[model samples]
Target: MTLEAWAVAAVLYVFRTLVDDDIPLNAGCLEPLRIIVPEGSMLRPRYPAAVVAGNVETSQAITDALYGALGVMAASQGTMNNFTFGNARHQYYETIAGGSGAGVLRFGERGEALEGHDGADVVQTHMTNSRLTDPEVLEWRFPVLVESFEIRAGSGGAGRWRGGNGGRRRIRFLEPMTASIVSNRRRIAPHGLAGGAAGACGRNYVERANGERVELKPCDTVEMQPGDVFVIETPGGGGYGAP
Candidate 1:
């Protein structure tokens, strides 16, 4: 249902420029569109089917799919980069930002001047525009240290309109707890359009106190002893046009 809502909005966004009539939030806009979801499908699973990931990761995938098919833009980072850590007394959840696909406009079109447009870095695209907790606030509340948070430059696809770059975040644990990563676009790269290049895939891992690094799967839950560092490299958005 959420995917359908986002898809509808995306379609409207691209078409609004060609039409003169206003498409109001009410029936005037929504009535023309119909959404269907099989009750048993993943989009609409059975009761208590554990579809929490659907809200975060799967939702973005659906939007990415829409973006590709509609030719509005390239794919954005397909994951929310959500992570959670908690002990008996405290729980913390944060969603990291990523790159956004470059703008979509044909040459000589109304927006032709933006042919060299590039995707925005460290953005929250398609899904909820969630803002991460301030590093100072996070460190003050949790037994964790914000080691680094920076842009993963060049991670985006190359094109006339280059794809956006993803981000990197590393957090060091100061105490023992359990941590989990829920994300996607690790295997499949975000696709490009109009002969553009595909975005780079994301990566995740843990660095133990001994400095040994262990790669994390798309979804993993692991124990984190004191001094362990968790690093998430979010996926980059796809390019919109050929370089």
Candidate 2:
């Protein structure tokens, strides 16, 4: 079998093992679903192609693509918002969750409005379900302080059904350290559907002790100094329908 097929099989196997066993734990469960991976594409990268982002970023893109193809709403913040920082002795890594896209509103048989579901807030979904680190644990283990963690208001797209909001996280360093960020949706916003507005784009930056602000790209690695502040504003999800 092709590499893509193998990967899908492995994913399905793990999923089956984790979920209920009501359905037979065999290949029959996958018989009904059709999966296609284009040759040399990101999903099926050719030899020597760097696939570091495939596990986190590309997988989210694939999920968004599938949802978009079904004319569902718009794309979510399609990144894992991976962040890592460390010194010579201590290292830390985290995956921050972003917003989820809103879907089209449903109607009843009598043409009456039904209960429309809103997108999820700052929470992980799909393939990446890792939990956030506790603030107390972080403070005890690393030379950093959690400045703030809160929902970013007015970040989701506007529509009949609004999308979920992203989150903002700020951290202050107690000592010099090195940091790296692997994320996406920095340049382009998550798209909306059916006349809905696009969601806000993500941002990564640093504030020096001298009050200097430096913007960072989607994938960046930088050296930081003591008293420097790192901030991450995750992207919001797109809206579904016209207002």
Candidate 3:
């Protein structure tokens, strides 16, 4: 049901956006649109189906496809950067921010207008719309410390209009806990549009207490011992114009 709604919304949103037209909620704009999905398809899952995993990846992929078909922009970081960590008592989950694809123009993560072919930087895009939690609040509640959280500068693709930049987050566990990372764009880079360049792929790893570094898979849970730090470097959006 979630995907169904999202697809419908995407079509309406993209239809108006391509021509820089305003969207009206009245029947004049929506009356001609029709959405039909076959039973039990990926978009319309049967009851009792799990959607968390599908929701994150499929929605973003769908939106990217929508825009790609219109040739208006490039692809954004396709994952929600889902992060979750917990022990027997404490728990935390968040969808970290990343770059949005560069179009003829785009806004900053804060909604400010940016020049040329640059997309928004370190902002929430696509299906990963969520608030960025305050670091102090996290530290106050959890047994972990936020070592660093900032933009992975220059991580965006280079183009006539550059792709937006992704972000870097490092959290050190003060106690033993379990941490899981579930995301995409780790292997395949976000695609560019026109004569633009492809964005950088995302990366995740752990710096163990013993100074050893270990890479993590797309979907994996790891034991975080004391002094171990988990780092997430999200993917940037793809550039839309020639470099």
**Candidate 1 or 3, higher lDDT?**
3
The per-residue C-alpha lDDT of model 2 at residue 65 equals 61
Candidate whose TM-score is highest: 2
By lDDT: ranked, best first = 3, 1, 2
State candidate 2's TM-score: 0.86
TM-scores for all predictions: 0.85, 0.86, 0.84
The alpha-carbon RMSD values of the candidates against the true structure, listed in the order shown, are 3.4, 3.9, 5.2
Best by lDDT: 3
Regions more than 4 Å wrong, model 3: 16-30, 34-51, 105-116
Off by over 4 Å in 1: 1-23, 36-50, 105-116
CA lDDT, candidate 3, residue 222: 96
List the candidate 2 regions with Cα displacement exceeding 4 Å: 1-26, 104-115
**Candidate 1 Cα deviation (angstroms), residue 111:** 12
lDDT of 1 at 86: 96
Error of 1 at 19 (Å): 7.7
